[model samples]
Target: MTRFSANLGFLWTDRPLPDAIRAAKAAGFDAVECHWPYDTPASEVKRALVETGLPMLGLNTVRGDVGAGQMGLSALPGRRDDAVSAIEQAVSYADETGTKAVHVMAGISEGAEAEAIFIENLSVACDLAMRRRLTILIEPLNAFDAPGYFLRCTQQAKSLIEHVNAPNLKLMFDCYHVGRTEVDVPTTLNKMMPVIGHVQFAAVPDRGPPDHGDVDYRPIFSQIAGLGWDQPLGAEYKPGGDTDASLGWMVKFR
Candidate 1:
């Protein structure tokens, strides 16, 4: 059972928020996820989730800077307070909406010192996340997608999860980013599967639907299916054209 989560942040962009939920439900996604509801009221989002009867997957915490400069500050020095506070707010949101997973990235490090600080800060956030009954998903962005990002490789993410030694903290494998950084998808996934808590996908280069790019999703998908990964496989790609038009290939997979 390869259950997929339709990313409302990218899919159904033209439709209203509620409509997006309905559309994803009809599209056969087992659940639906989106970025943080900064503009939309949580009540509205909650209503949509209830109406569609879809589980919420990933939700983001507020970054220290909303502007162009900051990615996130989860592990930076002097930002520990802000980082914890951000997760707290996200917990409040998640608690209300029954969302149990939060993606927490340590914003890019400026240097070795910053990297160490970020690791310490993330260690604290992990504890808090556990207390809140939420799973913390740490994503490692490739240098191409996010230059100067603190965690740039799956190896680094794996080390952090190991060092933290917390059960609730795990890695977020964004297949698109990993595909840009590594050559083999199935091999890389096998290497990082233990730490990987959530999985997302997008076509290479274009970051669109799975079939639109060179990455062969069939094998990658089959690999996970063999692993008995019953949770949702997040479809977190941007639609190059009409969302429905781009998703035609997935009908057979259903």
Candidate 2:
């Protein structure tokens, strides 16, 4: 059966993180994930998870200085110290919340120097997460949505994972980004499934619900299931109106 996870980062933004977890549970989601939850204490988040009995699939490392347009720190040259700090903080938080993975965001930058910095930081992240038996995920944000983001394609992410050679490091294959950048979601997914730690989806052009988009997800979901991926697919779409109203698409999966 195809299960789904509500990404609290986009869904239920009207409520608190803990409340959102309960909402996901109430909505019949199998799991939940988030972007950044540092603002909410780990204990409180854990309490909600415990109450709801839904696993926290993953969370991202802090995006350094949003005010400065810095989306992440891991790939920024000369910011190794900050990147390491962000990784440690994310790992600690994930540990406290019983989360399964950490998406190490590669901030805006490009070049051999930036790649080297990202690899160095990822090594550190993988080591820290391995201690907790947690997976470290690296996502490829499309150029349109995240111009200059160091890791921008599955091939690039695959090379990094192979170069790092860490068992704990994996890829976060988001369908929307893949559709925008690579243009062939199913083939890319099949080729990259070996290293995929997580998967997410949204409408291709608007990033809205997956039910209606440039890319039809029915066959894609079927393909993922056919490939033996039993884990819940993360729903990371923006709800144009009330989140509850946007949930009509979820009924098909259920």
- Candidate of highest lDDT: 2
Residue-wise C-alpha lDDT for candidate 2, range 228-249, written one tens digit per residue: 8999999999998899889988
- Candidate 1 off by > 4 Å: none
Clashes of 1: 3
* Cα-based TM-score, every candidate: 0.92, 0.99
lDDT of 1 by residue, 156-244 (tens): 88987887788988899989989988857788899998888999998886788888677888888889878767688899998877888
Off by over 4 Å in 2: none
Q: lDDT scores for all predictions? A: 0.80, 0.95
RMSD of each: 1.8, 0.7
Error of 2 at 29 (Å): 0.4
> Where does candidate 1 clash, by residue pair?
72-107, 75-118, 108-150
